[model samples]
Target chain A: MHPLAAVRGVPRRTWLRWRFAYLVLLPTLILFTYLRVFPTAWAFVMSFFEWGLVKPAERFVGFDNYTTLLSDKNFTTALLNTTIFAFATTIFSVILAIALAAVLARVVRGRTGGLLELLYFAPVLVPMVPVTLGWREIFNYNHGVLNAFLGIFGITRVPWLSDPNMALVAVIILSVWKQVGYNMIILIVGMRAIPRVYEEAAAVDGASAWQRFRHVTMPLLAPVTLFVIVITTIASYNVFTQVYVLASDVQGAPGRLVPVIVYDLFQNGFRFFKMGYASAEAVYLFLIILVLTLIQFRFLRGSRA
Target chain B: MNLRRRGMSRVGYWILVAVLALGGIAMIFPIFWLFSVSFRPASEINTVPPNLLPVHWTLNNFTVVFQRAPMLSYLWNSFVFATISTIFIVLTSSTAGYIFAKFKFPGNNAIFMLVLATAIVPFEIYMVPLFLQMNALHLVNNPIGLFLPFLVLSYGIFFMRQNTMTSVPDEILDAARIDGMSETGVMIRMVPRLLAPAVSALAILAFIQAWTAFIWPLLILNDPKYFPMELGLSQFANTGSSNFGVTSAAAVIALLPSIIAFLLLRRRIVEGITITGLQG
Candidate 1:
């Protein structure tokens, strides 16, 4: 209902109090829709048409773009690769984050604890480009830090990002390293919020340390855990700048992770000038995220019930 | 968790702390490596059985970076973009967040939810069309094009709204209104003062986001001088491996300002990031 709905049956001058909210909200709404909403809607509209940057014309192609996308090797690769990336990064990062938070929350307290927490949170500040580039150097096939360290143990140099089998793992590790701290901070706060009474109750019942955490702490931390999963999954699936720097020859070295979605989109839209085709890919990506997010909301609502 | 109350030994406690501390160091090792490699000579950078510390520390890489490109100018481009964008986003997000959190206006929930939904949609979804949109506006080669899309961030608005819900009480606004302050005046004078923490947190986050921005800037701008340092760092990698030392140095320089900003405002960044994570 309108803020003026109650006043609609009355006079306008009598209830003009809340109209300032609309006035203040206009700039943000206008700019946001203009920049974000308009472009997104335009992408959807262009997906069904043969929009080309080269020929400078558009034709209604219906589901042709979609069909073409479904058959594209790069598209299929991206679909599988992105799924693996999302789930792997989310799960691995979440597990490490939980363990770190639980331990730090228990063992460390005081100024030292605070300092350590800050140190843990430090990577969250580093950008994707630097982190990815740095890791690219570290993951180098020869003379890289990791390979050199492994060599110290009498192991041969192992190609990190270059090997097809290890490429996804390398990517996952790169992301997880940057992400764990943010999740740790969140989980720590979540753990801190869980009342000590629950733990005490579990303790009095003769639950061991592991048992108490498994039964009491884990159950109570479900909401935050679910949140972490959804966030990390969404972020991981969209990892582009890192992949661009790591895999593509955009930097000096060619990347081995061939089927990542955003990189595919970049190649299509920018490199190949297939704006319409790329738009279709974008639509699929958007729908996947939308469905995932909706599923999360549904699960949370169900848990509440 | 009061796990200590259950008769865990002091030795075990220190052992756990030491292990966790080691893990912490390991987690940030890449950053430490980046810093260490910044000073390493070209020979030591790719040496087998890599020296943990630089064998021959040199400022030569820094000199190469400066001589090769207008690196500081690139940093200036990034700094200006980050600063200006942060200011605009902070002002815009706070104003909108104040309304969404405090006012019961028409379309409040609907509009707020629309902004919230954008958080889930990655920029790639609309990035092609956005490129065309910028092209239409003749901003493809313009710096404004790089910063425009981020001027009002969804996460900033959402974070500010969450902070406002808890921080700014309605009674104070009412009191301000009663004292003859207009609605806008009340917001400008009182609400912002109260939202200082949220504003600072949002500002730091916005600064970093804009500073580290890559894809859009890479697409939007053409000239090397207009390039942000994030994009500039790519040249080192793209051009060749011979400049590996300077490449690492450039990467360090690119990340330095944001790291400094984050260090100065780690408390706020942590709070801001947590609110985002919690709400998600």
Candidate 2:
């Protein structure tokens, strides 16, 4: 104590070291508090009040908004559509990605792997607006590429975006087109990481490649598969661009996913000045996502156990 | 044994190639068409027999887009905003990533978990209030308005943190401490080289996020003059009644920078995607 008391003044070096991390973290904390946490809290509070976009007054409406949303047929249909979109895309994409990645992992050598990956990943870089425009042209009934190609096989032209019966499928195709590459790359990496020793051991024991893969690789890749399923499902549920572009008219008028519902709310809330209803809708969509994510977490936990 | 294995492998290779070749064409044909239609005269875009390839390529469409829409202005706006936003993101996330990776600070685990938790919340949900906050701060319609919110990415932080935690060994930090390097000095000098992969990945992700940021900017910026490329492209699409050619051309212009950027940094982009997806 006597020796340390003699050196009363701490060095500038120690002073700077003490505050370095906080200096880095302080701005981030403030930013997140303002942008992320505040918005979420405001959205929640706003859900309980009837407010106008332009007006300052917010009347406490309590549970009426929730009741109204529950009775709204459009809301129910959007919820259903969101569920369908999420499950369908997740299943198809997971299966297709695993199959494609498994195949590519085997044969692609050196430079070809990079080229194939480049081609597959091109869509990720392509912005949503242009991608939607290209899809519109591709899905065009008369002069569209898909119809033109199908004509060679004598199949009748399909009204992809126009027909409500097929509109969901069209959106699904775009979602798959945009996302499958991403999922595939992930799976390919996962497949590559499976030690070659397992395959060689299986081969030595007279196991076929498919059997070896099913027993050894697939089981090992289960965590990756689970991760993809949950993330893709959530992403598909929240899909906005394709729906916003394709169903330009009557977007809120039943039979679209939840994000479309959110978009509709955006228009109504901001554009038409119905802020209360929009906040209510936002909360509803939040609950749906919350429940789905909770289910996914539980599923992952159960699988792990 | 050798012949059978060789034959099987060859057959597998060809089939994979055939399918992927087909799939690749199907994927890239849209991009090809976007370019083809962009250069063709307006009349040729959706003609009776739609042209697969423009007979006479011209800069006329680009010229029209530049004249009709503030395409160049919008592009400039996007470039400035994205560049600034990306720089901040890289700087802040890398530093925070370093802190979380190296130091055993108080509440670190809780903070990390909170950052990770925020990842599950859709970014779109924060738009309205963010707009309100920006308005209160008088940041609306400013480039800083566009740049600031995107600067702090939870995903980037989490990514950098994970990368650092795995690769930046404590022994290295100990050695630096022994050499009397301050923590900031050690981080600044050492982390960047070690964080090449994470930084590259985060940069691409940050660039893409800022570039495609539509709804947030649409809410915050009221002026058409301040619109990013995404909003500009949407404007072109929305005014579909009068100016299909210009709209399509504007779309073409919007496509250029992203595709070009991706081409230039394709490997980094792919690496970034694979890393994020693997961590999924």
Top candidate on TM-score is: 1
True contacts kept of each: 0.74, 0.43
| Candidate 1 per-residue C-alpha lDDT over B1-280 given as tens digits, one digit per residue, 9 for 90 to 100 | 4667583678887887788788888878888788888899888877877778898899999888878777788889988998899999998999988889988755779988899888777888999988998888889889878888989888778888898999998889889888988877888899888999778767877887888888888888888878987887776566674456787888888888778867787677788767655765
The interface root-mean-square deviation of each model, in the order shown, is 2.1, 3.3
Cα RMSD of all models vs. native, in order, equals 2.8, 3.8
Show pairs that collide, candidate 1. A78-A259, A247-A255
Q: Which candidate is the best by DockQ?
A: 1
How far off is residue A156 in model 1, in Å? Answer: 2.0
After superposition, candidate 1 runs with Cα above 4 Å error: A1-10, A54-57, A249-257, B5-7
Q: Cα deviation of A77 in candidate 2 (Å)?
A: 3.0
Q: How does model 2 score by TM-score? A: 0.89
